[model samples]
Target: MGGTGTTGTTRRISRSTTAALAVTGLVTPLTLALGAAPAQAAPACTAGTGPYQKKVEKFLGRPVDGRQSTADCRAIKAFQTKHGITPNAGYAGSVTWGVMDLMTKQKAVGTNPNRDGRCPVNKGRVACVNLTLQLSWIQDGRTLVYGPVPVRTGRNGDETRTGAKKIYWRNIDHYSTLYNVPMPYAQFFDGGQAFHQASVSMWNPPGSRGCVNMTKTAAKKYWSLLRNGDDVHIWGRKPGT
Candidate 1:
């Protein structure tokens, strides 16, 4: 089974009029000809400056004015919408900025995520999970084989256990009896915690139970690159967990 995604409804907006309306916190109602069906007005983008306005502007590659603008609001809203953030009102609040900060760190990992040498490089074909960055990758004796793909680890109390382990079992279509959720391409490592494909957004807040949640593509690749008895080294504490 593949991961699930959400589809959003698109609305037609008159750019010139919408921009003006958004600035004044007014609704931009859709204009229709006679006898035409009425359509819902698009949600007005936020116009007030946020706490992290400057940071958000910098991240979005917009002018660092620290003030909200129509272009900036659209860019931030697009990012929030893509990442499944709620409201997505183009406000540069802590939540939106937090996600952006995580992205910045994830990007910094770059092509050499294991440069810190924290994950065991001596082990042949090891799957390394860095909970701090919420990233996972496959390596064969210091040589990178797969990714530093984004992942969602266990949340707060049910944190994913840290330490070295081995892939003891694998189930292509595993069902979590405890949580009653589908765990596709599951590879068990520590206790009930495993690496599996997640049905929800990886960027969703709070995170998983104890399982290492991955995107469908990442989970499938991990399945192909790893197998039973392969080394699995996990370390670091997940941020906010």
Candidate 2:
């Protein structure tokens, strides 16, 4: 087997664009073409605003006081780490804000699944994964048990499969036979593609080899809520897929 790179979700923002956004206000849409990809470093907390803060809170499914407090940073860091954001520094920086903004926008446009339609009829316990937004939710019948949690799916050459399946097996501490990396709380649904916990980058050049990677916290909650043979429905194409 070959050495696979660590997984992450990074955007290609040019330095010139970053500088220009600082001048014209980061809210303005960029007209300049994006240049080469750079390191997934976060910008300073210079673009704070009520709207941005509100959006962050909304995406996190919680109420933020518009202060970006320590708790808020922790939440943001978790989200970043889950989605493969670099640094995972817990700041609402440009990359973090960008992904949140895009997710909200996608929801508004009806591209992602609605909260109302997250689970199937009469399904007691199920996991719904939206690849487009890299978000997941667990539902028991009509009640949302957990999530809208950030996740990182297979990337490019290793794209995760979408559709219905069941968790046929589980492992609290598992190692990938292919990559030899830790896959905590693994719930195997599709062959070689389980719902597991793994470290992520915001924009790492490498993605998972068909698994749905989530944060340790989210994965633990999933392990607790899900048992073998529970339904798992994965759908939607990732943004730019």
In lDDT terms, which candidate is top?
1
Per-model CA lDDT versus the true structure: 0.75, 0.62
lDDT per residue for candidate 2 within 159-188, as digits (tens), equals: 778888998887766666457677777788
Clashes of each: 0, 10
TM-score of each: 0.77, 0.57
Candidate 2, residue 232: Cα displacement in angstroms equals: 0.2
Best by TM-score: 1
Clashing pairs in 2: 8-201, 9-202, 9-203, 10-202, 10-203, 84-201, 84-202, 85-201, 85-202, 86-202
The reply for model 2, stretches above 4 Å from the true place, is 1-100, 103-113, 116-118, 201-206
Q: Please report how far candidate 1 places residue 152 from its true position, in Å.
A: 1.0
Indicate the residue-level lDDT of 52 in model 1: 98
